[model samples]
Target: MSDPITPTPEPADADAGTYGPFAYLTAPNSVLYRRVMRVLMVEKERFTVHVRPEQVYAGVAVDGGDAVTEEAVGNALESLADGRWGNLLAFPDSSRVTAIEDFYRRRMLFQLSRAGEAAERALAQYDAALGTRGSLQSVALEDIVALLITLRHTVSEHATGATVDAALAHQTLRSLRERFVELADNAVAFMGSIQRTIDLHDADVEAFLAYKEQLVDYLERFINDLLVRGAAIAELLGSLDAASIDVLVTIAAEREAVDAAPGEAETAAASARQAWLRQWSGLTDWFVSTPARESEAKLLRARARSAIPALLAVVRALHEKAGGRTDRTHDFVTLARWFATLPADGDRHRLWRSAFGLTPVRHLSITAATEDAWASADLGNVTPWADAPPLEISPQLRRTGAYERRGKAVRVTDRSVAKALLVDRARQEAEQTAAARRRILTGGPKPLSAFGVLDPESFRLFLALLGDALAAMGPNPETAQVHTSDGELTVTLIRTPGSGVAVINTADGTLAGPDHLVDIASAVDEAAGDLVNWAAG
Candidate 1:
């Protein structure tokens, strides 16, 4: 107030010529004011500052360049502890400080308040800078935006106080705004790059999902085809078993021998004598007409009568050759009587014609006793033979004549009889040939049931499914084919050709693959174990 309190000169190291309230406070004559300005400037930069009436007095004394004790500093600090300094610094009207002393006091208070707020804000900004120092280089776009907002606030706050130099404030705000703008641009660029990366990742993942779905579908179809093919092989084997042919060689040999005999004269005469007896006996007996009777009565009687004599003669010859009893003779009367009573007109005559050297005749009525009797009587089997009774013939000859007895006549001819036998034999041969053909064509068993086995349509579906699987497996060049036991199924794997890789099945035709035979066997065993457990459950 007095003489405007001119301050002392500034130190040589001070930045520039002082201006405003600080200029008056530092004049050489106003030692107190000069010391006060020095204390205020130094303290404001170093430690926390409080401005009160008592602290203001201390500041004026310290301005005289006197050394202030620790107690003095403490008293000054305590005096400014209340909030009066804050009110003065915040005074709304800038025109209130008319004098130099008033300007000095008011400006000092304003500088202190503004410096404190700037220091606090600077400290916060420094901490923020330290916390995000590395982050500014690598932080996301959102974090950069947040940092810019804080920086803007800090610059604005620092610009508010009148105590701060107008030029310094302008410079700081300009620099801060420039920094914020640069950071915001960098953040925008960073966000755009990150979004692009995310878009690429999404596209790749979607493609992978579609590929996986296709792969699964292919695998399912492949397995189904393998199973169907295996079943087809099994069905084929069954058909083969049903059609095997078995030839009766013994019957064929007997037929050959009968075809080899000599002359129509002796054969016809022997046939006529046998025909007459067959007609008379068949009319007399019903029981003797059956097939059972032919074997028991006619065949046994024939054997007893004809074969026994030869067998006895051979035994006699052998016994004589061995120097043993040769006089042991078999009773021929029992054999002769059995033959005499047999149904002459029965199937026995046809059997006799087949057994003896006689030409076979048509319409011989060998099917039943009554028919045979009528046929034999008409052909004359009911009458006696004119010359010798018919002699026993070789076992090779087959019966082949019609008989006449009394005035009845039965005509016997080779042509008609041969045709009937040929037709009968043809039927038998055809059946045998067809059965053999079926056996060869169908493997071994009967055809599978309509629904139980895989049909042609199902097989086609299986092929399609297998084709899909092969495509999904990515064009394997190797391949393998296998047949099932029943000769029905044929399984094929489409794989990398010439590659060692292959798909195979178990001996029982179960699907197995992706490994060697040994590995497939092991896998099958494991699968069987699982099946057993499932069955128990």
Candidate 2:
């Protein structure tokens, strides 16, 4: 209903508001208004704002201070209680005439009305709004998950029926049982927290992602761990007579009996047996009975199993939230709707000013205290930053120089040890190289298979030698010895029948397939083994 262009705070009603008695607050001088209001706020309990001009300026007078006087304080008090500021009423709480008998004793007392209370509350609210507002932080699901996992592991270890000392078992059970209960309780609590986090206006996307992932991982892990423990427990429950861990059952039964006594003092053996019989109902409910109120261990497994799908559903909800266009914020969307329907130049201009505060800067001034303005208010020839050198059009421009590696030459703590390590590394390298060569040298000099089927490396070698042998066939079908450049090995090329000139595919033409053969042999060792690939190096 109000003008949006020049939006401002609603003015307090002059006749109806508490500030009516403190009308001097609207004075042109802000310091006096604030100081007087602060004094009232600080001493609101005192019925009389007993002002004495002498006491008001006592500290200032001690420092040889300024022009404050008794008349000034009295004038201020009178002005505050005047008919113009109708919110205050003057009164005397004195029983004796001596209350105002002397100038030093004379003081003004005033009580604030309903309007003053309202004004003070408004100011208090303004001050309070300056504090940091509460912000929503995404769920810390991973921490809870980690704690639950630790508790699960502890339960698993104890449930294995290891022969632990009685005291140790008691301590471990007490500690782990407390932690496990807390973790289980927190799992349910954390789901509510997840919903709260997702509902937040400014939820951290990265933190939410982490929380979602950790929670899903937690649920999956719980499902797996619970299944394993459940199977083990079920087996233990089903095969109590067949197990060698019967001591575990005996110890548990004893523990149950001791607990049923309802006191700290240990019962005698006969009394313990009586207690055990009395408490057999608990044991029956726990490990003996298969129906009607199953044991807590089975319930734990069931809850853990059920929680997986519940967590998965939560994850689906989170994903649905994440997989959407963040079109705009709520406040901005509302503002945009208002702007669309505003349809007025003045309203538009006011909206612009209110949104960005683009009104002219009022408090800035330029003074020639240090330096003069630029000589000309023009930038005709000014150029952006550049090197004096002309841009070169060459590969050198694209080139990058490699940095020299700088490493501190650490003194070897033990010279012999360093030398031994270096030698061992060298020996390892040499042996690896030699082993590759040995595999390549042996069993590779045999005749080419029918249809020229060869290993991948051997096929490459065939291609390279095919052209050379074909070029220098020299009109003879006898074997040709081609010594390699290094002459450490020799390749003997021999012609063989191709089973009546088989035709094969080729780039130039269908090849009259070669009958040439390659027999690999080391020059120094006639009985060399299969060729090693390292020899090609």
Candidate 3:
């Protein structure tokens, strides 16, 4: 337990100060005042609502030590009273007075004020939130499912004219909402913590590596639970009609409406119902899928799945680090130290050459006779250059530091014939492709069956366009449209109800599929038509 807060001088009245109830927190003696208030608050919790000045002194003295005098404690208590910061309520302790001398002392008691208690609660919650690393509570999900089932059954009973417990219904709904809130908040926090863990920020490398095996398993288990249990939850949510949900909301709201002010029962009920309905809507959306969006459950599962790979990547990195691989930076540092200890500049230069081998060797200009002798010799043993015969260097290389070959320059080959053939072949292919594209687009929008018999070139082009459109269509879209890879044409495929298969004859084979409404139009711009044609080629 901590000590209470210090106090300031009492104001003329409870409302005299312009400061709020927590104003003592910023005062010069705020520490002492907070200690005094904490003592009062703790005593209040223990059913000692009104604390005496001596009690406050004893509590403050625990942490403050002898530095906190009785006079200081009394002054701190008075400063926190209703007249000053309104952190405490001052009461006359007449029951303790025994004689005229005791009466003159004016024994008083201190209790925490409503504003003061609210401020303390806020501070306590702030501290808790700051420190909390929330978790993934799969049990919370189970509890939520159970609550929803209970509510569903209760609503059904109420609908069929069966006796129902309103209080139980309200309590169950409240508990369900709270549990859901905790689950969502904890899951988000846990996922965030996992990311930080993966980054290895502030984590012990060895410990994290040891813990990661279990962490990965934990995430995997949670993902499995979510997938299995999430589906059941979504099913339950879908089975409950809006009217049934509204009935339960109404029951919970009416039960709470009793707390409203006089003559405001109807208004309170309506507000509570609206609030409950909004919460219910959020709950439904969290589990049930809509046309425009996937449920949060699916998204959470995807995030968890992605984290598994990331964790493995981190583990791989850690393993590499632990493999005792040589570091480039460390090698450079060691090399620098070796260089630093050298006694001579020439030795340093030689060490640098031996270490890097960046210096060029100039003895490659050997004569034809010498090269033949060196190649034919059975030379396996090492021979220092100092003990070997000198190489025959060319005069030009010795003078200019470069070898000059003694020969005529090679003649450049003529490629104009090959270039002309390639150009002609590309032109012919481009012409054929453009003709095929035009033949398909010229027909405009028509049923797939009406395309009739297409030439091989046109059929290939048609297949390419159809493949692009279908790829854009995804799983079960009613219609899909896409520009060709060359952006010279746009193809659209729209499925129709009760459509039959369409077969198109080609020289190579036949193609068959749903007789969809197919449309291919030229999408080329006049400015970029040349570019598009070149790309097609």
Best by TM-score: 3
Q: Give the lDDT of residue 444 in candidate 3.
A: 55
Ranking by TM-score: 3, 2, 1
lDDT of all the models against the reference?
Answer: 0.38, 0.48, 0.82
Runs in model 3 deviating more than 4 A are 1-36, 57-86, 89-108, 200-202, 323-537
Off by over 4 Å in 1: 1-110, 113-124, 131-537
lDDT of 3: 0.82
What TM-score fits each model?
0.13, 0.23, 0.57
Clashes within 3 Å, all models in order: 54, 15, 15
* Candidate 1 CA-lDDT value: 0.38
Best by lDDT: 3
